[model samples]
Target chain A: MTKSKLSQQLAVDNLKIGSHVYSSRLIVGTGKYPSEDIASKAINSSGAELVTLAIKRFSQQDAISNILEVIGEKKLLPNTAGTLNAKEALRSAQLSRELFKTNLIKLEIITSSENLDPNMPETIKAAEMMVKDNFEVYVYCDRDLNNCLKLEDLGCVAIMPLGSSIGSGRGFDDLDDLILLRNKIEQILIVDAGIGVPSEAARVMELGYDAVLVNSAIAYANEPILMASAFKNGVKSGRKTFLAGRMSRSKSSIASSPTQFLK
Target chain B: MSRIKIQLNGTVEQIESANLEIILNTFAPKDRPFAVEINGEIVPSAKFSDYSIQENDKIEIISAVGGG
Candidate 1:
């Protein structure tokens, strides 16, 4: 291969989730926006090819404008966010498949209401059920390498590890674990949740993660549209930096000029 | 005309008939995409006209909502 061609491939390119290829590596969500107008605008500014959504009972009062109507041409990734057990998660997945007409399902089962941490056992069960049902599962879990590996073995299309508790905005709690997971797994790694700013998103991408899913960060920002744009640039910059390779850390200062100066 | 009572999104509602299509026309927004489930079984939109709802059948009409 030509040097330029090979170098171009090294730079972060399109993202592949399951069989579908997307141009953007950042995935935004459609929740917590002041209005549907802002949400659509933010998503558009983010340049996200895929967006996350939830399945809820239809309510005419709240249905003045449908969420599907605003989000045009982007792939929908329906998540089982409210489910507490494997059974509920499975039901949500099934219903999402029918509603969105897509096999992509973000499996998130949280047991505790306060922490909103993933119920690993329940997530596993739901992943198994989703796999059996022929859905492309993206399992969300803590930054535990073992758990992520297990999900990969279950045929999950993606492994989404939380940077911290969902929506806490605490940022990455353990950088070591994240780097370790990146080194250990071959499946698509997406750092989901707790990304408060563009820098956090960039850091995750710099660690060689395939993608970063930002929701509350952009939605709650003072300017959702602007924050969305910032995140888009952040993800791209970090990916390019990663491909360029960073300089090694040094304990002692090294002189860039001649050691001896003319007296 | 006979009426049937069914649970709609966890609330009991009285409808004129047991037909799924009529019930949807009354409750669902025609412009949006939605999925119907009766007693935990998904009824495809194409089958709505032919499907009959049983008494006390738990029905849920759902659509996409904002979430992350």
Candidate 2:
């Protein structure tokens, strides 16, 4: 491998937000599976080291004890999914830390239900508080580069900029913004939400993102295990492609015509 | 009756009698994310029937919701 290729590999390898090491560079969630068994199988098939779980009321019930038991060996990441303010986000972070025994948190402070857009001020406040409390914060922000930079400045260990919106599956609607965010932040940059298919994940990886966090895309698939495997392969292939260093694009077509014969 | 002790997901607990449902119900109300580990082996909630508790058998009920 060339120096640039080696660096690219190292960059992919270094996407760990805290103590977790994920080879696939794609983190999945366990929420939307039809059953716990299927969810467990999908998670195992995905080969994701870290998995996200939205902290909700059902978690407190005993009905899902079996599900929790199945995922005992994997790292459980709790998200502040429904939290609207900094206080709620902080409380959720604390609860997650207490329940999951891990300081890693995915900060999601939504300001509007329609767009599921992040409240920048609330997200910044929550990030500051959670980081101070010794949590490795991964803030999910808007696709705007400015919001991502602001979150990075607030001490977030990683910045998860959305591609469109949660579960939109639109897939990289703003490539320029994502590229700018990747360039501006020194910390980990993960493409979270709005990814609809495996190719979207591959595209994000190809764009030099550190990782991709997915949930509904895989969970809602008709064949989740197969989709999980597809995502795993896509992420790996995309990372490898980025490491190999893609050729620069040309404005005009360079046809391989018989130039020598013509001359 | 002798004291039947077991490990619940790594935590040690002593309960009287070998009734599985009662023991599980006791710990269920705690609202902690846990899994039952009996005698160094994981006992899925579905298989709570095949194995009966013996005296002094270490039962570990591991809780996922622990302080970071």
lDDT of 1 by residue, A75-169 (tens): 99999988999999999998998888999999999977766889998898889889999999988898888889999999999999999888888
User: Candidate 1 — which residues are off by over 4 angstroms?
Assistant: A1-6, A10-12, A258-263
The local lDDT score (0 to 100) that residue A140 gets in candidate 2 is 87
Error of 1 at A162 (Å): 0.4
Query: Model 2: runs farther than 4 Å from truth?
Result: A1-14, A58-65, A112-115, A255-263, B1-68
Chain A, model 2: TM: 0.89
lDDT of 2 by residue, A63-90 (tens): 4455565555777777887789998888
> Per-residue lDDT for A212 in model 1?
95
- In model 1, the clashing pairs are none
DockQ for candidate 2: 0.05
Model 2 over residues B1-68: C-alpha lDDT tens digits?
Answer: 67866665345677885876667777653544544555545566677655678866776544432110
lDDT of 1 by residue, B44-68 (tens): 8899999998889999999888899
Question: Which 10 consecutive residues of model 2 chain A have the lowest summed lDDT?
Answer: A55-64
TM-score of each: 0.96, 0.75
